[model samples]
Target: MQLDLTTFILEVLNFLVLVWLLKRFLYKPVLSVLDARQQRIQGEMRKAAVLQEDAARLKQQYEARLADWNTEREIAKQSLEQELARERDTGMKAIQQSLADEEAKNRVRAASAIATREAELVRNATSGAYRNAAAMLRRMASPAMTLAILNILLDDLASLSEKRQEELHKAAHPENVTTMEVVAAHALEESAQRKLGDAVAKVCGKPLQATFKTDTSLIAGLRISLGESVLHANLADELGYFRSQDKNV
Candidate 1:
Protein backbone atom coordinates (compact mmCIF):
# COMPACT_ATOMS: atom_id res chain seq x y z
CA MET A 1 0.00 0.00 0.00
CA GLN A 2 2.95 2.28 -0.76
CA LEU A 3 1.85 5.31 -2.93
CA ASP A 4 2.72 4.92 -6.68
CA LEU A 5 3.23 8.41 -7.99
CA THR A 6 3.75 7.43 -11.65
CA THR A 7 0.64 5.25 -11.87
CA PHE A 8 -1.54 7.88 -10.11
CA ILE A 9 -0.31 10.55 -12.47
CA LEU A 10 -1.03 8.32 -15.49
CA GLU A 11 -4.52 7.55 -14.22
CA VAL A 12 -5.22 11.26 -13.67
CA LEU A 13 -3.94 12.05 -17.21
CA ASN A 14 -6.24 9.36 -18.77
CA PHE A 15 -9.30 10.65 -16.85
CA LEU A 16 -8.72 14.21 -18.13
CA VAL A 17 -8.39 12.95 -21.75
CA LEU A 18 -11.66 10.91 -21.44
CA VAL A 19 -13.58 14.02 -20.08
CA TRP A 20 -12.30 16.17 -23.02
CA LEU A 21 -13.28 13.51 -25.60
CA LEU A 22 -16.80 13.10 -24.09
CA LYS A 23 -17.28 16.89 -24.13
CA ARG A 24 -16.14 17.17 -27.77
CA PHE A 25 -18.04 14.09 -29.12
CA LEU A 26 -21.27 13.46 -27.07
CA TYR A 27 -22.20 16.64 -25.11
CA LYS A 28 -21.74 18.99 -28.15
CA PRO A 29 -23.86 16.83 -30.49
CA VAL A 30 -26.63 16.36 -27.94
CA LEU A 31 -26.70 20.09 -27.16
CA SER A 32 -26.89 20.88 -30.92
CA VAL A 33 -29.90 18.51 -31.43
CA LEU A 34 -31.71 20.03 -28.41
CA ASP A 35 -31.17 23.62 -29.85
CA ALA A 36 -32.62 22.60 -33.31
CA ARG A 37 -35.72 21.01 -31.68
CA GLN A 38 -36.30 24.11 -29.56
CA GLN A 39 -35.97 26.37 -32.69
CA ARG A 40 -38.55 24.19 -34.67
CA ILE A 41 -40.98 24.34 -31.75
CA GLN A 42 -40.68 28.17 -31.54
CA GLY A 43 -41.14 28.53 -35.36
CA GLU A 44 -44.35 26.33 -35.25
CA MET A 45 -45.74 28.37 -32.31
CA ARG A 46 -45.15 31.67 -34.28
CA LYS A 47 -46.94 30.26 -37.42
CA ALA A 48 -49.94 29.18 -35.26
CA ALA A 49 -50.22 32.64 -33.73
CA VAL A 50 -50.22 34.25 -37.24
CA LEU A 51 -52.96 31.77 -38.45
CA GLN A 52 -55.15 32.57 -35.38
CA GLU A 53 -54.85 36.31 -36.07
CA ASP A 54 -55.89 35.75 -39.74
CA ALA A 55 -58.91 33.67 -38.65
CA ALA A 56 -60.04 36.41 -36.23
CA ARG A 57 -59.78 39.04 -39.02
CA LEU A 58 -61.84 36.82 -41.42
CA LYS A 59 -64.51 36.28 -38.72
CA GLN A 60 -64.81 40.06 -38.15
CA GLN A 61 -65.16 40.67 -41.92
CA TYR A 62 -67.93 38.02 -42.23
CA GLU A 63 -69.81 39.46 -39.25
CA ALA A 64 -69.63 42.98 -40.73
CA ARG A 65 -70.94 41.73 -44.12
CA LEU A 66 -73.83 39.92 -42.42
CA ALA A 67 -74.76 43.04 -40.46
CA ASP A 68 -74.73 45.12 -43.66
CA TRP A 69 -77.00 42.58 -45.42
CA ASN A 70 -79.42 42.59 -42.50
CA THR A 71 -79.53 46.41 -42.52
CA GLU A 72 -80.16 46.47 -46.28
CA ARG A 73 -82.98 43.94 -45.94
CA GLU A 74 -84.61 45.97 -43.15
CA ILE A 75 -84.36 49.15 -45.22
CA ALA A 76 -85.90 47.44 -48.26
CA LYS A 77 -88.72 46.07 -46.12
CA GLN A 78 -89.52 49.51 -44.73
CA SER A 79 -89.47 51.06 -48.23
CA LEU A 80 -91.85 48.39 -49.54
CA GLU A 81 -94.21 48.97 -46.63
CA GLN A 82 -94.28 52.72 -47.28
CA GLU A 83 -94.99 52.17 -51.00
CA LEU A 84 -97.88 49.85 -50.19
CA ALA A 85 -99.34 52.35 -47.74
CA ARG A 86 -99.23 55.14 -50.35
CA GLU A 87 -100.97 52.92 -52.91
CA ARG A 88 -103.67 52.00 -50.42
CA ASP A 89 -104.30 55.65 -49.56
CA THR A 90 -104.56 56.60 -53.23
CA GLY A 91 -107.04 53.80 -53.91
CA MET A 92 -109.20 54.80 -50.95
CA LYS A 93 -109.37 58.44 -52.13
CA ALA A 94 -110.38 57.41 -55.64
CA ILE A 95 -113.15 55.19 -54.30
CA GLN A 96 -114.50 57.97 -52.09
CA GLN A 97 -114.54 60.47 -54.98
CA SER A 98 -116.39 58.01 -57.20
CA LEU A 99 -119.05 57.47 -54.55
CA ALA A 100 -119.52 61.20 -54.02
CA ASP A 101 -119.95 61.84 -57.76
CA GLU A 102 -122.50 59.02 -58.05
CA GLU A 103 -124.49 60.39 -55.12
CA ALA A 104 -124.57 63.90 -56.64
CA LYS A 105 -125.83 62.53 -59.98
CA ASN A 106 -128.60 60.62 -58.19
CA ARG A 107 -129.71 63.77 -56.37
CA VAL A 108 -129.85 65.76 -59.63
CA ARG A 109 -131.90 63.04 -61.35
CA ALA A 110 -134.34 62.88 -58.46
CA ALA A 111 -134.88 66.65 -58.47
CA SER A 112 -135.49 66.68 -62.25
CA ALA A 113 -138.10 63.93 -61.96
CA ILE A 114 -139.91 65.76 -59.17
CA ALA A 115 -139.99 69.06 -61.13
CA THR A 116 -141.38 67.33 -64.26
CA ARG A 117 -144.19 65.73 -62.24
CA GLU A 118 -145.20 69.06 -60.69
CA ALA A 119 -145.28 70.83 -64.09
CA GLU A 120 -147.50 68.07 -65.58
CA LEU A 121 -149.96 68.37 -62.68
CA VAL A 122 -150.16 72.16 -63.05
CA ARG A 123 -150.89 71.90 -66.80
CA ASN A 124 -153.69 69.37 -66.25
CA ALA A 125 -155.36 71.50 -63.59
CA THR A 126 -155.24 74.65 -65.73
CA SER A 127 -156.84 72.96 -68.78
CA GLY A 128 -159.69 71.50 -66.69
CA ALA A 129 -160.45 74.85 -65.04
CA TYR A 130 -160.48 76.67 -68.41
CA ARG A 131 -163.03 74.22 -69.92
CA ASN A 132 -165.32 74.35 -66.90
CA ALA A 133 -165.40 78.16 -66.89
CA ALA A 134 -166.28 78.30 -70.61
CA ALA A 135 -169.15 75.82 -70.16
CA MET A 136 -170.66 77.74 -67.23
CA LEU A 137 -170.49 81.04 -69.15
CA ARG A 138 -172.31 79.51 -72.20
CA ARG A 139 -175.17 78.25 -69.98
CA MET A 140 -175.98 81.75 -68.56
CA ALA A 141 -176.85 83.65 -71.85
CA SER A 142 -180.19 85.57 -71.98
CA PRO A 143 -181.89 88.02 -74.36
CA ALA A 144 -182.52 90.67 -71.60
CA MET A 145 -178.87 90.33 -70.45
CA THR A 146 -177.70 90.72 -74.08
CA LEU A 147 -179.84 93.89 -74.50
CA ALA A 148 -178.40 95.40 -71.31
CA ILE A 149 -174.85 94.55 -72.54
CA LEU A 150 -175.54 96.19 -75.95
CA ASN A 151 -176.76 99.37 -74.18
CA ILE A 152 -173.56 99.40 -72.09
CA LEU A 153 -171.45 98.94 -75.30
CA LEU A 154 -173.21 101.96 -76.95
CA ASP A 155 -172.56 104.04 -73.79
CA ASP A 156 -168.85 103.01 -73.81
CA LEU A 157 -168.52 103.98 -77.51
CA ALA A 158 -170.10 107.35 -76.71
CA SER A 159 -167.66 107.90 -73.80
CA LEU A 160 -164.56 107.26 -76.04
CA SER A 161 -162.15 110.17 -76.69
CA GLU A 162 -162.47 112.09 -79.98
CA LYS A 163 -159.17 110.59 -81.28
CA ARG A 164 -160.18 106.91 -80.49
CA GLN A 165 -163.66 107.50 -81.94
CA GLU A 166 -162.09 108.90 -85.13
CA GLU A 167 -159.74 105.86 -85.31
CA LEU A 168 -162.69 103.48 -84.93
CA HIS A 169 -164.65 105.38 -87.59
CA LYS A 170 -161.63 105.18 -89.97
CA ALA A 171 -161.30 101.39 -89.34
CA ALA A 172 -164.95 101.00 -90.61
CA HIS A 173 -164.23 102.53 -94.08
CA PRO A 174 -167.02 102.12 -96.66
CA GLU A 175 -164.46 100.81 -99.24
CA ASN A 176 -163.43 97.72 -97.10
CA VAL A 177 -166.94 96.97 -95.78
CA THR A 178 -170.16 98.91 -96.56
CA THR A 179 -171.57 97.61 -93.27
CA MET A 180 -170.26 96.88 -89.76
CA GLU A 181 -171.45 93.62 -88.17
CA VAL A 182 -172.91 93.73 -84.64
CA VAL A 183 -172.95 90.31 -82.91
CA ALA A 184 -175.00 89.55 -79.80
CA ALA A 185 -175.82 86.56 -77.58
CA HIS A 186 -179.52 87.04 -78.56
CA ALA A 187 -181.47 88.81 -81.33
CA LEU A 188 -182.20 92.53 -80.73
CA GLU A 189 -185.70 94.10 -80.93
CA GLU A 190 -186.39 96.42 -83.94
CA SER A 191 -186.64 99.46 -81.64
CA ALA A 192 -183.33 98.50 -79.93
CA GLN A 193 -181.55 98.05 -83.29
CA ARG A 194 -182.70 101.52 -84.49
CA LYS A 195 -181.51 103.06 -81.24
CA LEU A 196 -178.15 101.23 -81.52
CA GLY A 197 -177.64 102.41 -85.16
CA ASP A 198 -178.28 106.03 -84.15
CA ALA A 199 -175.77 105.74 -81.28
CA VAL A 200 -173.17 104.07 -83.57
CA ALA A 201 -173.57 106.89 -86.22
CA LYS A 202 -173.11 109.54 -83.49
CA VAL A 203 -169.78 107.95 -82.38
CA CYS A 204 -168.58 107.30 -86.01
CA GLY A 205 -169.42 110.92 -87.21
CA LYS A 206 -171.13 109.39 -90.29
CA PRO A 207 -174.00 106.97 -90.68
CA LEU A 208 -172.98 103.40 -91.73
CA GLN A 209 -174.92 100.25 -92.78
CA ALA A 210 -175.44 97.62 -90.09
CA THR A 211 -175.71 93.77 -89.83
CA PHE A 212 -176.71 91.72 -86.76
CA LYS A 213 -175.98 88.16 -85.63
CA THR A 214 -176.96 86.09 -82.59
CA ASP A 215 -174.12 84.04 -81.02
CA THR A 216 -174.95 82.57 -77.60
CA SER A 217 -171.26 81.88 -76.84
CA LEU A 218 -170.89 85.56 -75.94
CA ILE A 219 -172.91 84.71 -72.75
CA ALA A 220 -174.42 88.25 -72.48
CA GLY A 221 -172.72 90.94 -74.58
CA LEU A 222 -172.27 92.78 -77.87
CA ARG A 223 -169.31 92.46 -80.27
CA ILE A 224 -169.01 94.95 -83.16
CA SER A 225 -166.73 93.70 -85.91
CA LEU A 226 -165.75 96.16 -88.67
CA GLY A 227 -162.46 94.84 -90.04
CA GLU A 228 -159.51 93.31 -88.08
CA SER A 229 -160.71 95.22 -84.96
CA VAL A 230 -163.61 93.85 -82.90
CA LEU A 231 -165.24 95.78 -80.01
CA HIS A 232 -165.81 92.98 -77.51
CA ALA A 233 -167.94 93.59 -74.38
CA ASN A 234 -168.50 89.89 -73.61
CA LEU A 235 -168.34 87.53 -70.63
CA ALA A 236 -166.44 84.91 -72.74
CA ASP A 237 -163.62 87.39 -73.57
CA GLU A 238 -163.35 88.46 -69.91
CA LEU A 239 -163.30 84.80 -68.87
CA GLY A 240 -160.48 84.10 -71.43
CA TYR A 241 -158.38 86.98 -70.05
CA PHE A 242 -158.85 85.65 -66.50
CA ARG A 243 -157.92 82.11 -67.69
CA SER A 244 -154.69 83.42 -69.22
CA GLN A 245 -153.81 85.11 -65.91
CA ASP A 246 -154.48 81.90 -63.99
CA LYS A 247 -152.31 79.81 -66.31
CA ASN A 248 -149.46 82.28 -65.84
CA VAL A 249 -149.86 81.92 -62.05
Candidate 2:
Protein backbone atom coordinates (compact mmCIF):
# COMPACT_ATOMS: atom_id res chain seq x y z
CA MET A 1 0.00 0.00 0.00
CA GLN A 2 2.64 2.41 -0.88
CA LEU A 3 1.42 5.44 -3.00
CA ASP A 4 3.28 7.48 -5.51
CA LEU A 5 4.31 11.11 -4.52
CA THR A 6 2.33 12.91 -7.23
CA THR A 7 -0.99 11.13 -6.46
CA PHE A 8 -0.65 11.77 -2.63
CA ILE A 9 -0.09 15.50 -3.18
CA LEU A 10 -3.26 15.83 -5.33
CA GLU A 11 -5.41 14.10 -2.61
CA VAL A 12 -4.10 16.49 0.15
CA LEU A 13 -4.96 19.57 -1.98
CA ASN A 14 -8.59 18.45 -2.48
CA PHE A 15 -9.04 17.83 1.35
CA LEU A 16 -7.84 21.43 2.16
CA VAL A 17 -10.41 22.93 -0.30
CA LEU A 18 -13.37 21.11 1.43
CA VAL A 19 -12.43 22.43 4.96
CA TRP A 20 -12.28 26.11 3.79
CA LEU A 21 -15.75 25.93 2.22
CA LEU A 22 -17.41 24.49 5.41
CA LYS A 23 -15.78 27.17 7.66
CA ARG A 24 -16.89 30.05 5.41
CA PHE A 25 -20.54 28.97 5.10
CA LEU A 26 -21.94 26.78 8.08
CA TYR A 27 -19.51 27.24 11.12
CA LYS A 28 -19.33 31.05 11.01
CA PRO A 29 -23.16 31.54 10.92
CA VAL A 30 -23.73 29.22 13.98
CA LEU A 31 -21.05 31.03 16.12
CA SER A 32 -22.56 34.45 15.25
CA VAL A 33 -26.05 33.34 16.59
CA LEU A 34 -24.58 32.24 20.00
CA ASP A 35 -22.70 35.57 20.49
CA ALA A 36 -25.88 37.68 19.85
CA ARG A 37 -27.84 35.68 22.57
CA GLN A 38 -25.06 36.24 25.15
CA GLN A 39 -24.95 40.09 24.49
CA ARG A 40 -28.80 40.50 25.03
CA ILE A 41 -28.69 38.71 28.46
CA GLN A 42 -25.86 40.98 29.73
CA GLY A 43 -27.81 44.18 28.76
CA GLU A 44 -30.96 43.00 30.75
CA MET A 45 -28.82 42.34 33.89
CA ARG A 46 -27.32 45.89 33.82
CA LYS A 47 -30.81 47.56 33.59
CA ALA A 48 -32.05 45.57 36.68
CA ALA A 49 -29.06 46.73 38.83
CA VAL A 50 -29.69 50.45 38.03
CA LEU A 51 -33.41 50.21 39.02
CA GLN A 52 -32.54 48.64 42.42
CA GLU A 53 -30.19 51.51 43.34
CA ASP A 54 -32.90 54.15 42.51
CA ALA A 55 -35.41 52.35 44.84
CA ALA A 56 -32.96 52.44 47.79
CA ARG A 57 -32.46 56.24 47.39
CA LEU A 58 -36.25 56.86 47.32
CA LYS A 59 -36.80 54.82 50.57
CA GLN A 60 -34.19 56.90 52.45
CA GLN A 61 -35.81 60.19 51.36
CA TYR A 62 -39.26 59.06 52.52
CA GLU A 63 -37.92 58.11 56.01
CA ALA A 64 -36.20 61.54 56.44
CA ARG A 65 -39.40 63.45 55.46
CA LEU A 66 -41.49 61.47 58.06
CA ALA A 67 -39.02 62.24 60.88
CA ASP A 68 -39.10 66.01 60.10
CA TRP A 69 -42.92 66.02 60.26
CA ASN A 70 -42.93 64.31 63.68
CA THR A 71 -40.46 66.89 65.12
CA GLU A 72 -42.56 69.80 63.85
CA ARG A 73 -45.69 68.33 65.44
CA GLU A 74 -43.97 67.96 68.84
CA ILE A 75 -42.81 71.61 68.81
CA ALA A 76 -46.32 72.85 67.91
CA LYS A 77 -47.89 70.84 70.76
CA GLN A 78 -45.49 72.32 73.35
CA SER A 79 -46.16 75.87 72.15
CA LEU A 80 -49.95 75.37 72.46
CA GLU A 81 -49.62 74.04 76.05
CA GLN A 82 -47.61 77.10 77.12
CA GLU A 83 -50.16 79.49 75.65
CA LEU A 84 -53.05 77.76 77.48
CA ALA A 85 -51.27 77.93 80.86
CA ARG A 86 -50.61 81.68 80.54
CA GLU A 87 -54.24 82.37 79.65
CA ARG A 88 -55.53 80.42 82.68
CA ASP A 89 -53.29 82.29 85.14
CA THR A 90 -54.24 85.68 83.74
CA GLY A 91 -57.97 84.97 83.93
CA MET A 92 -57.81 83.77 87.56
CA LYS A 93 -55.87 86.84 88.69
CA ALA A 94 -58.36 89.16 87.04
CA ILE A 95 -61.25 87.46 88.83
CA GLN A 96 -59.60 87.78 92.25
CA GLN A 97 -58.92 91.50 91.75
CA SER A 98 -62.52 92.14 90.77
CA LEU A 99 -63.79 90.38 93.91
CA ALA A 100 -61.54 92.42 96.20
CA ASP A 101 -62.67 95.69 94.63
CA GLU A 102 -66.32 94.81 95.04
CA GLU A 103 -65.83 93.95 98.71
CA ALA A 104 -64.17 97.31 99.40
CA LYS A 105 -66.99 99.19 97.76
CA ASN A 106 -69.59 97.31 99.77
CA ARG A 107 -67.84 98.08 103.07
CA VAL A 108 -67.68 101.77 102.27
CA ARG A 109 -71.37 101.90 101.47
CA ALA A 110 -72.27 100.15 104.75
CA ALA A 111 -70.23 102.59 106.83
CA SER A 112 -71.84 105.59 105.13
CA ALA A 113 -75.32 104.25 105.78
CA ILE A 114 -74.53 103.63 109.45
CA ALA A 115 -73.20 107.16 109.93
CA THR A 116 -76.35 108.68 108.45
CA ARG A 117 -78.61 106.60 110.70
CA GLU A 118 -76.63 107.52 113.83
CA ALA A 119 -76.80 111.23 113.03
CA GLU A 120 -80.58 111.09 112.59
CA LEU A 121 -81.06 109.28 115.88
CA VAL A 122 -78.91 111.80 117.77
CA ARG A 123 -80.89 114.71 116.38
CA ASN A 124 -84.22 113.21 117.39
CA ALA A 125 -82.98 112.42 120.92
CA THR A 126 -81.54 115.88 121.53
CA SER A 127 -84.68 117.64 120.33
CA GLY A 128 -86.82 115.48 122.61
CA ALA A 129 -84.61 116.20 125.64
CA TYR A 130 -84.76 119.96 125.09
CA ARG A 131 -88.55 119.92 124.78
CA ASN A 132 -88.96 117.87 127.96
CA ALA A 133 -86.66 120.20 129.93
CA ALA A 134 -88.57 123.31 128.83
CA ALA A 135 -91.92 121.82 129.83
CA MET A 136 -90.72 120.49 133.23
CA LEU A 137 -89.14 123.83 134.17
CA ARG A 138 -92.36 125.78 133.56
CA ARG A 139 -94.47 123.44 135.72
CA MET A 140 -92.03 123.06 138.69
CA ALA A 141 -91.72 126.85 139.34
CA SER A 142 -95.09 128.62 139.22
CA PRO A 143 -97.93 129.81 141.50
CA ALA A 144 -97.50 126.57 143.50
CA MET A 145 -93.81 127.35 144.14
CA THR A 146 -94.62 130.98 145.10
CA LEU A 147 -97.18 129.82 147.68
CA ALA A 148 -94.63 127.50 149.21
CA ILE A 149 -92.06 130.33 149.49
CA LEU A 150 -94.64 132.62 151.23
CA ASN A 151 -95.43 129.99 153.87
CA ILE A 152 -91.70 129.59 154.62
CA LEU A 153 -91.29 133.38 155.02
CA LEU A 154 -94.29 133.56 157.45
CA ASP A 155 -92.84 130.79 159.57
CA ASP A 156 -89.54 132.74 159.89
CA LEU A 157 -91.33 135.95 160.94
CA ALA A 158 -91.52 134.87 164.64
CA SER A 159 -87.71 134.66 164.82
CA LEU A 160 -87.10 138.15 163.31
CA SER A 161 -86.46 141.27 165.51
CA GLU A 162 -89.20 143.87 166.00
CA LYS A 163 -86.97 146.50 164.39
CA ARG A 164 -86.29 144.23 161.36
CA GLN A 165 -90.02 143.39 161.07
CA GLU A 166 -90.88 147.08 161.09
CA GLU A 167 -88.31 147.72 158.40
CA LEU A 168 -89.80 144.91 156.25
CA HIS A 169 -93.39 146.19 156.80
CA LYS A 170 -92.44 149.71 155.61
CA ALA A 171 -90.86 148.34 152.43
CA ALA A 172 -93.79 145.99 151.65
CA HIS A 173 -96.76 148.28 152.61
CA PRO A 174 -100.15 148.18 150.83
CA GLU A 175 -99.47 151.70 149.56
CA ASN A 176 -96.12 150.49 148.07
CA VAL A 177 -97.92 147.55 146.37
CA THR A 178 -99.42 149.94 143.75
CA THR A 179 -96.27 149.85 141.60
CA MET A 180 -95.69 146.04 141.96
CA GLU A 181 -96.96 143.64 139.25
CA VAL A 182 -96.93 139.85 138.76
CA VAL A 183 -95.82 138.40 135.36
CA ALA A 184 -98.45 136.35 133.49
CA ALA A 185 -99.73 135.48 129.99
CA HIS A 186 -101.65 132.66 128.20
CA ALA A 187 -99.12 130.47 130.12
CA LEU A 188 -100.68 131.52 133.47
CA GLU A 189 -104.36 130.51 133.57
CA GLU A 190 -106.97 132.44 135.75
CA SER A 191 -106.51 129.86 138.53
CA ALA A 192 -102.73 130.30 138.46
CA GLN A 193 -103.00 134.13 138.66
CA ARG A 194 -105.45 134.00 141.61
CA LYS A 195 -103.14 131.65 143.49
CA LEU A 196 -100.17 133.92 142.77
CA GLY A 197 -102.00 137.06 144.07
CA ASP A 198 -102.93 135.28 147.36
CA ALA A 199 -99.35 134.15 147.87
CA VAL A 200 -97.96 137.67 147.26
CA ALA A 201 -100.39 139.25 149.75
CA LYS A 202 -99.45 136.73 152.46
CA VAL A 203 -95.70 137.40 151.99
CA CYS A 204 -95.98 141.25 151.90
CA GLY A 205 -98.93 141.72 154.37
CA LYS A 206 -100.60 143.82 151.65
CA PRO A 207 -102.89 143.48 148.67
CA LEU A 208 -100.61 143.08 145.58
CA GLN A 209 -101.08 144.43 142.04
CA ALA A 210 -101.50 141.64 139.43
CA THR A 211 -101.27 142.05 135.65
CA PHE A 212 -101.52 139.66 132.64
CA LYS A 213 -98.74 140.66 130.28
CA THR A 214 -97.51 138.59 127.31
CA ASP A 215 -93.74 138.57 127.12
CA THR A 216 -93.16 135.43 125.04
CA SER A 217 -89.41 135.54 125.60
CA LEU A 218 -89.97 134.55 129.28
CA ILE A 219 -91.22 131.36 127.50
CA ALA A 220 -93.65 130.18 130.22
CA GLY A 221 -93.39 131.32 133.91
CA LEU A 222 -93.96 134.14 136.43
CA ARG A 223 -91.98 137.19 137.50
CA ILE A 224 -92.72 138.95 140.82
CA SER A 225 -91.54 142.36 141.92
CA LEU A 226 -91.71 144.24 145.23
CA GLY A 227 -89.89 147.57 145.14
CA GLU A 228 -86.40 147.31 143.54
CA SER A 229 -85.94 143.68 144.72
CA VAL A 230 -87.43 141.29 142.07
CA LEU A 231 -87.90 137.51 141.98
CA HIS A 232 -87.42 136.52 138.34
CA ALA A 233 -89.11 133.12 138.65
CA ASN A 234 -89.03 132.26 134.94
CA LEU A 235 -89.16 128.71 133.41
CA ALA A 236 -85.39 128.75 132.69
CA ASP A 237 -84.65 130.10 136.25
CA GLU A 238 -86.36 127.13 138.04
CA LEU A 239 -83.58 124.62 137.30
CA GLY A 240 -80.95 126.61 139.26
CA TYR A 241 -83.26 126.92 142.25
CA PHE A 242 -84.03 123.18 142.32
CA ARG A 243 -80.33 122.28 141.95
CA SER A 244 -79.47 124.63 144.88
CA GLN A 245 -82.20 123.05 147.01
CA ASP A 246 -80.95 119.56 146.18
CA LYS A 247 -77.42 120.50 147.27
CA ASN A 248 -78.74 121.82 150.61
CA VAL A 249 -81.02 118.84 151.21
Please name the candidate that would achieve the greatest TM-score relative to the true structure: 1
Instruction: Give Cα distance to truth, residue 34, candidate 1, Å.
Output: 17
lDDT of 2 by residue, 215-236 (tens): 5445445556667556555554
Q: Clashes per prediction?
A: 0, 0
TM-score of each prediction: 0.53, 0.36
- Which ten-residue region of model 2 has the weakest summed lDDT? 145-154
Q: TM-score of the candidate numbered 1?
A: 0.53
Worst 10 residues of 1 by lDDT: 171-180
Off by over 4 Å in 1: 1-116, 161-167, 245-249
Which digits, one per residue and each the tens of the lDDT, describe model 1 over residues 171-197?
Answer: 765575567798887899998888888
